[model samples]
Target: MLKILKYSFYEMIRSRWIFIYSGFYLIASMALLLLSNDISKVLISLTNIIIILTPLIGILFGTIYYYNSKEFIQLLMAQALSRWSIFTGMYLGLAAALCISILIGIGIPLIAYGVLGSAELSLFLLLITMACVLSIVFSLMAFLIALKFDDKVKGLSISIFVWLFFAIIYDGIFLLLLLGFKEYPLDKLTISMIVLNPIDLARILILMKLDMSAMMGYTGAVLSKFLGKNIGMIIISFSLLLWVILPLWTIRRVSMKKDF
Candidate 1:
């Protein structure tokens, strides 16, 4: 597993996509900081970008990597290795490469700006943490899709649709529901809805950290009013953790059972 992991990690680390991904964040962060003296404002702006872009990149890169390396993957499967180890190692390697890109991409500017005060530092860490977790979760999802479908086109399409649904469509539908049923209490429902979508959960958590719950609109206020910040963070964090774990478990199952 470690060898497979090292190979995948180093291989992906050399990818031009990783460099572009890292460079985008670096340039965007620096630009935002240059434009705004307010660190919180800069973070909120980056949060919007990270929350949407990270998962998209994760899925795209994961599916492309898996498909491009299909021959090598098959070769590895013929070896004396556990399928679990092979898939898990590959997934971890891909995810680790992404997470590091995010860290370096965003971390440099935040640190240079002296965002190291207790409150600001925690917020910055939370942003990076959420970005890393999103990368892991979606990349795992992409791998699972790739493993399930033999056709690269089908796998990549489904993977992208999954990202689209979570990042955009889900919110649109949720808003329609809120509008149609604004007469009743939806605090619990709202929380459940947000928890169900990792993107929404991450956005809410970051907004809370920024002390900009008001910007979250009704959903944010309800989240704060009902659960309070700390408890809400715990629930959302656990939900995000489940997002990572469930896909991983599914990937393992599919990899073990598949004929590959």
Candidate 2:
């Protein structure tokens, strides 16, 4: 596993897209810093970027890598390597490369600005945490989906649609439901809705870190009121964790049953 992990990590780190992904973050971070010399504002901006880009990048990167590495995967499978080691290693390695990109891309600017010691420290950490979580969650989802479909085009399309559902359409449906049922009690329903969508859960987490629950919308406000800050954060964090784990577990199961 470690050997496969090292190889996967090295391969992913050396990929052209990894550099592009990290470069984008670096440029964005620098631009945000120049525009607003406040670390808090920078963090909030970064959070929004992470929320949007992480899933898109992860979905694309994971599926593309899985398909592109088909030959490599088959070659490894012919060897004595366990499917578990080969696959989980690739997943972890990809996730690690993404984490590095995020850390260096955003961390450099925050450190250079010398705002690491301010009250925004916690928010900064939370932003990084959520970004990393989002990366792994969607990337693993991509890998699992790719494993399920034989055709690259089909796998890619499904992965993208899955992302769209979670990242955008899910929110739209939630809003519509709320509007359609404003006359009914929706406190618990609201919490359930946000909890079901990882992106929304992430937004709530960051909003809480920014201490701006008012921006959390109706569902978020209800969640905040019911669970309060501390408990709500714990639950949201746990939910995000499940989002990360479920895909990884699915990847393992699917890889185990499917023949290369």
Candidate 3:
């Protein structure tokens, strides 16, 4: 498993797409920080980037890597390599590659700007943690989704659609529900809805650290009451942890039964 992980990680390090992803972050972070000269605003912009782009890239890269490694994986299996090791190694390898890209891409500019010594250091750590977690969560989903559909095109489409649903449609539907049932209480329902979408869960977690005036808003009140400050953050962190575990477990279970 460690050998498989090393091969996959080193292989992806040479991948052009990973370099491109990292470069994109490098250029964007530098521009945002240098141009705006405001760490707070740069962090906010970065949060949006991490929340949106990281998951998209994670899922796409995971699926493509899976298909690309079909022959290699088969060769490994022929040599009696365990299925879980192959899958887990590949997943961790890909996830690690992404984490490195993100860390280097954004870390350099942020540190150069002296984010480490600032009071916003914890917020910076939270942002990076969520970015890594989000990457892992989506990559696992992409792998499991790829396994479910042998057709590459369909697999890719479903992956994008799942991302779109969580990133966009889910929020739209949640808002409509609040508007449609404006007279009724939706405190608990709102919290339940956010849990169903990992993107929203991440946003809420980071926003808690930001402590914006918007935190005094309606949804914030609902979350505050239901999740109870510290407990809420713990639950969100635990939930993100669950998001990573469930899909990998599913992949292992399914791989055992299927002749991959």
lDDT of each: 0.89, 0.86, 0.87
- lDDT tens per residue, model 1, 52-124: 9999999999999999888999999889998889888898899999999999999998899899863578889
Candidate 3 colliding pairs: none
Model 1, residue 113: C-alpha shift (Å): 1.6
How far off is residue 30 in model 3, in Å? 0.2
**How many clashing pairs in candidate 2?**
0
Q: What is the lDDT of candidate 3?
A: 0.87
Candidates' RMSD to native: 1.5, 1.6, 1.4
Give me the displacement of residue 111 in model 1, in angstroms. 0.7
Per-residue lDDT of 5-47 in model 3, one digit per residue for the tens?
9989999999999999999999999999877977878999999
Better of 2 and 3 by lDDT: 3
Flag the better candidate by TM-score, 1 or 2. Answer: 1
lDDT of 2: 0.86
Off by over 4 Å in 2: 215-221, 227-231
Instruction: Give stretches of model 3 more than 4 Å off.
Output: 213-216, 225-228
TM-score of each: 0.95, 0.94, 0.96
